[model samples]
Target: MTIKSLSLKRKKTAPHGLSEPTDLSAYRRIVVLTEGHTNPQKAKTAIGLLRFRGGDVVALLDSQTTHQSAAVALAHDVDVPIVTSLADVSQPDALFVGISPAGGRLPPAMQGAIYQAAQQGLDVVSGLHDFLVDDPALVDIASRTGARLIDVRRNGFRETAKHASFREGCLRVLTVGHDCSVGKMFAALEVERELLRRGADAKFLATGQTGIMIAGNGVPIDCVVSDFINGAVENWTLANQQHDYLLIEGQGSVTHPAYSAVTVGLLHGCAPDGLIFCYEAGRTTTKGLDHVPLKPLTDLRNLYEALAQARNECEVIGVAINGRRLGPDEAAQEQQRVSAELGLPACDVYRDGPGVLANAVVALREQVVD
Candidate 1:
């Protein structure tokens, strides 16, 4: 993809309660804007444009990848204002707009506004693709608006592959569970980091970021691995392909609405080799805990039995702990409690030293495939 193809500069809505002008000014300090989600190659091109211009980049918005869109994937760390209208945008020294797959031509009223903005000397730039076959009125408006259009999508994926490389056969670990846990996604990342530190290659296929709103309630965890799930049989059919084991994570009550039962259903369809359950062992963030009947292990064990029932040969691993900081003795006590309650050999991720997570994974690997 050429620099002109990303609709990075287009104005869009900012998330609510973020309308302070100071925040807007902070975003305007950057020059290039890439819109929507893009694959790695297209994302790299957008980054390159910013570097070449010697200006900071502001990702326009997130959406268009698997969960939100490719925009979130490519613009991972950049500051983006969830914009609702162009009026919220501060006049940048220059603007580079990224087009969506359908192309990002402004409608009549928007085009007229841009034209007026151009007359006042805004250097507007846009990257739109060649596939826009309709909307002459919009095209006519853009023509009058003097917005420079650049096409950038061709060969973007190939260029992206330059940065993409396969792992050295890591134990693929997946995190699944409750929808309401505040820092559970971080727990997944911690698992990945722990495994990688112990020389296990870990690939994290997550629904979205750590925060709840970004991840959204009722977001299908399968959406995270939809493409991989669809292509699994074919990829397996490629005899020369290296085989990497998968670890699927799920949360909430197995019966909770936001729980990953449906996601687990998709994995059952793909048929993975093992599953891990990460659960909160302490009081939940919700209220009325005193009145609720809570038999944590009984609830978890029942869920495990159901999961094991539907699968081919698959080993189940149980992980439990409170999120609060604990002393060494308290930590060890919790570990023993979980191991006994779950009726399986378990290790405290913290107390068994940092390498315990890796050791458990290796032990599980030997049981399942070795």
Candidate 2:
């Protein structure tokens, strides 16, 4: 059913917490090292940062795809050069390990390149589970060269007693998804842009490494201790208290075997006024774990709404479909099917614009007032 048809009522209280936005200006001129993996699906961090970050991305280091532009490889029409080695890059402030391989391990062949960057006194940034700072060789090199090794996944945790404080007049909308890499961040960003274009006081809150790189301020929620996951979210929300709308980026899926905790934590953390459920069309199961089948749209909606209502009243305002893999006809058909099944506005935010979901948020806000 549509959000208006849902029985949930809005809570009149604000969540409690403390948060400080991150500073990304230090990463002004960066060299993204993708090496063997340079495709969009694999080099998500590199592509995202290059696409959204306001800083100057000097080059994308990929030996195999040297001489080709980012537009050719990722099909995004970015002007950054793809170089074979760091020697080809000009003066850069940082060297970012931009690919998240299957096991999150640093590629063996790329270690020498990282060392080279460290030797040159350029800051090194990595988002893998394996922390580069922990490596003795890299640590020693960075210490000697006066370069900093920033593990985005591990660094930046401000221990605070403050939790998320729900703001009275702000409209907080979170983007939830069926699985990781389902375009939750992309949808949330587009929605925020659309809201701003409509003259709404909207703000986008980043929750992951790529988003943090883009927004210049956000907590990598998955890196935080489990005890403080929700607390981190609440604190981030509280930081944007002045905004009329806060479009918070969501993490993993509730059904994901490995990352469900992050999903549930974010859900309760933001205590959003509304949610936009994101799903990738033509995907029936979780990535990597083929055994876990994706829950149907109706079941997924019920699960999200039930959990949200248990804490504070919330509803699934609309559906954002990621139709990157599907043809136009197929995407439209899938969108129509999902809308009919869930009885909610459904569209691909990237292709169709975020108007549908943005309209839903505006309508909901007006409904609350009336």
Candidate 3:
């Protein structure tokens, strides 16, 4: 069956002045839309869903690279076939917008594809700052077809943090970064998995679009206003306090000129018990900010520690390296160099399993007698 002939059970995933669970698990066969963008950074949503969501993601929609395997470009282990249109794929439960453009604007091609998918009775899921529900044309078609518009970032802006602390005895860790897309979320996800495997009550707190989509629920902190960013983080942390470990995903670099506010806000709001410093192996400049330079792990560790001290006492306990650009031997060497210089265990979470970082967490927990 190429086209879905049934009506979608339209429901609001975005919490509008009300509390609701965000779950994307009901979508069994999702078609990831990343037309011209299939790279690691540009198509992060698609890549993340493929790598983490596993077999639920059926195909990648990229007309520019039709019939080509998306494994290499997306660094995915699965061979997600690239197709041109909705008809090219089988019965899709939903069409996922899998690229985060600078302005959150959908490309013309993706916009048309999403519309067609909705008209065909497939629910549309988006992670962009631009909510698809606002478009009358798309909404009208979806309404007529009984299809839902799932905007992941549309939730969690109505909160205002009255305090900036992760309640008492909350064993939470935050991933600090040298730059954006350097594997903070990936490392956090892996670490969460490892922690759970060890029988700990671990929860991965999603703070971005990709994380939100993968985890099915999280506050899109980047879309939050300056005054309420801290509150939003506080809100989510409070909700998940019962978990033994809350692995909060970090945002952009503190040195990043464009996204430093969210970084500092999370640092203050979460007041993490421990911090994991994530950095790319061979990058000297900030992504998309050519004029800005990325600081070394030592420098970032010191800065993050200092910033966290204002609200809570915490230390950077481990190093997670994003060595995607380097080969295995080179990545190993970089990890060794980082461990030696920083006096912390380091690993490329994607290249290696989460054992190293998880061990570091256990060490910290034991050392503190928690």
Candidate 4:
């Protein structure tokens, strides 16, 4: 019951002569491996955009039955390719990987395969959420390999602006996750009000719950995601309704379909200047810790390097913190570590709670205008 098995059946076969890849020298392809449909749409949009700009993309999507099965699926996704490894991927132009915490330190089999790939001289880009890596050994591997390991949750704050510009003088912000993060919601609203008070036309877009709330917060929980997604095209189509600056908020883990659908829709519609990823640093589900602790790639200088591989079309801004209080010191330290690892200014919402961040957002908006 805990372990779910999944096998992919290519809906359609590739064209004959085209079945065997030609010289990839001119075309750099990217293969995206994921656990199920949760964020495949989002991952696909990102992968596609990056490829369209130049690189080639090959996505190997998967569906893990239980959350615990994510690692298993990732292991398979990676190893399967090695078993049927590409002829020219040996010297790939670049490689990107999205790792979930449950997938826990790439399985030994996959690690061996990766080592082999490295022997062939392939540099890989990998990502992790803040809470996923508490293990020292795994972090070490990322460091030595020179892999771009990132904490996806917060890659939005500092890095997103590269993709979508903020209103000349407005705040560029977003709320992540599809499930309601009352903490993040209130924080965004207060920031908006503060920006308006300062005279900036701060534009805000809500994905999933936040979007539903924008249409009207009383939305039924059951239809939350569908209503938001269905209404998105119409909402975006409305002119004069657009703001000089844009901020999008994601609610829920990257593994949720709502999260995937909304993010993909946003990218397909009007890709944000940047992506802001908010995660519960210590938030735990029945499946254990939800975030991947990526201790590796700490010295790479910012998560942009890793995100560039995950989704290059947009700049990534990351915000990380432990949503729960284990201890004041521990929470603060975690925030510091996350910020340090990503090479961005850390927003320790836990210290002053949401109020301080709300105020800080106001200050950031003002600076943006200046």
Candidate 5:
């Protein structure tokens, strides 16, 4: 897709929010707007987009790392130009708001960059809970300039969905974690990508903004009303139930002080066949909640399985370790120790690739069928 395709603007609404999500595959190239923010927690969405977009990411808008390679900055193996802004990238189709900072609010620097991109008629997409589509100024800019404001979190909510009777032999695997942002979405997406590479019919069911943007459409479960979280999960699952493997992106943590509700809701609602326990190797505390020590992986695994047993007989199949903060040797050692301790396959999905975990999950389904 070219920038012209994104300029077919529609006036947005307050309730359901903005224009429908566009299929990302159509975008020939995209510029991820990071505004040079490099904190891993802050730049995670940008990093994820660049990793999984399959070479569609043309440039990264980061003034701090401008003229450097994105691989060097994000610690990923992929290579993409790190440009200052949309102007630096020639004919990029869209601009993605790629920072998932502590608060969902857009930093002023990012806002200015987005405004410029919208004025330049680039369709702007964001997964941030701070809804850009609802901002009157941005709405007006999009309306006047005919550039669509695509809110990945708010748009494309599946309607008229029922509790699914998923396809026979198909599986739903939810990524549960020890804490918020412990690589649940990253692990889930990486496994899905691996399965797809193997020619398996796998789909990633996005429950968060970043996951939704990556998948092109999903329900941001955090944004849903409490009473409707199950319905929302059911809705998204039904939409993708045909795939042989549905990797649902998990949110928060079952033990998280603030976000436990969303975590339990996903566990109960998704009716997963197995869970992938995502963890950061050395993170002892919740990202923001320094007081609540992270539960041991065994405790976490048991709780998740017990919770799943309350509804269906789901189990924790493997562990997805986030070793981004560790050196290569340390990351490998940590994975080995964790795997031996848990008696489950454990690997850093990004650092080591998703093969080990993917095989375990696929084997689970096949073993059950057998």
Candidate 6:
């Protein structure tokens, strides 16, 4: 089959959150405003969600790739139209700031679209570190037009209360990773899905933009103040105390120089009963920092377990590898090697399904009972 045809088929069968109903039901028709950066890697929030939940996508606003199919610009076949301006799109219920540029600052070119969207009485959803509500012009427009400005990143600022002590009723599984973008969220969501499929009560706790978009509610851990990071995570965990399992989405790696604080906070906050360490196959060094070589999977696992155990008894039950860049044979070999070396269940959750990791979590619970 052609590449386009294969992508289309994958869209129908891929286990990437499309099978589940989304919490964004109120936003039935939405426009993704990505402007200059239309590539999927840059416009991940918009492209990723639309790839899985295309029914909600009305159009992608990218002046650079106007009139192009979203599949062509994003490298994923969501089959949505790309319009140059809001004028080109039919009235949409909401306009989402889709691109998350480095430093999290809002791009100047995108300002016009935000203004236009608000003036047209469309709700604005922004995930940038720079809040749209902070801008005087946009705020005035939104206030006058009765358009809601939703900032997904401003989750923990409203509450001054500290987190409750970590309680131990339900089994909590956190997906810790060796580096950024190594499929931590993917593994956590897949494991949650697998557990639910087997008739277990489970909820996937989101800690990032994409996860928040998928679940429709979550604290953006990275955007919270350093002092309140743990409190934010603890609050989310306690709210979902009724579940049999809570699959917590983890953030950056503990070894990552820039984001280690976020990782440390999450580990102590949730006090996960178990962790699924995620690593990218064949990635020898951390992304953007070539001098920082990756530690052995065993070492990473030990570090995570030790940190978690310091607060509460925690174990590294499995390893989830991101083998998207590796061939099938090589990926399988790496999975086997990691499993043997770490002495834990190991597999790429996306490629091999989350059954191995799900089974590992189930077995660990059994051991705890015994």
Best by lDDT: 3
Which model is ahead, 5 or 6, in terms of lDDT?
Answer: 5
Taken over the whole model, the C-alpha lDDT of each candidate is 0.39, 0.79, 0.82, 0.37, 0.80, 0.79
Across residues 218-292, which tens digit of lDDT does each residue of candidate 4 receive?
A: 111122244344234323323213454545444333334334454443343343334444555654431233453
TM-score of candidate 3 versus the correct structure, residues matched by position: 0.92
- TM per candidate comes to 0.45, 0.88, 0.92, 0.39, 0.90, 0.87
RMSD of each: 13.5, 9.7, 2.8, 19.1, 2.7, 8.3
Which has the greatest TM-score? Answer: 3
| Clash count, one per candidate | 50, 10, 1, 45, 1, 0
Regions of candidate 1 where Cα sits further than 4 Å from its true position: 1-179, 182-184, 209-243, 249-251, 258-263, 284-295, 325-329, 344-354
Candidate 5 residues 1-370, lDDT tens each? 5757554434443434445555554566788888858545578888777767747788888776534777777777777878875778888788998887765777877888888888887788887778877678887787777676777666444443355666666788999999988889888888998999999988898888778767777777887777778777876677677788999999998888888998988887788889999998889988887988998989988899999887766888999998878999999899889999999999988778899999998998886545
What is residue 221's positional error in candidate 4, in angstroms?
12
lDDT of 1 by residue, 16-120 (tens): 211111111112333333344344433333433332222344334322234332235554444244343344556444444432222234323234433433443
TM-score, model 6 to reference: 0.87
lDDT, candidate 6, at 287: 79
lDDT of 6 by residue, 1-370 (tens): 1111221112221211112222343566788898988886688787656854578788999887754788888877568888988889765777888876656899998999999988986777788898876787777787687666777776534343364554455788899989988888888888988999999888899888777876677768899888888877887788887887899999889988999999999888887889999999889998778999988877888889889998877899999989978999999898989899988889988679999999998887777533
- Candidate 4 ranges with C-alpha deviation above 4 Å: 1-172, 177-187, 209-211, 214-242, 257-259, 284-313, 318-322, 350-370
Q: For model 5, state the Cα shift of residue 299 in Å.
A: 0.9
Model 3 vs truth, CA RMSD: 2.8
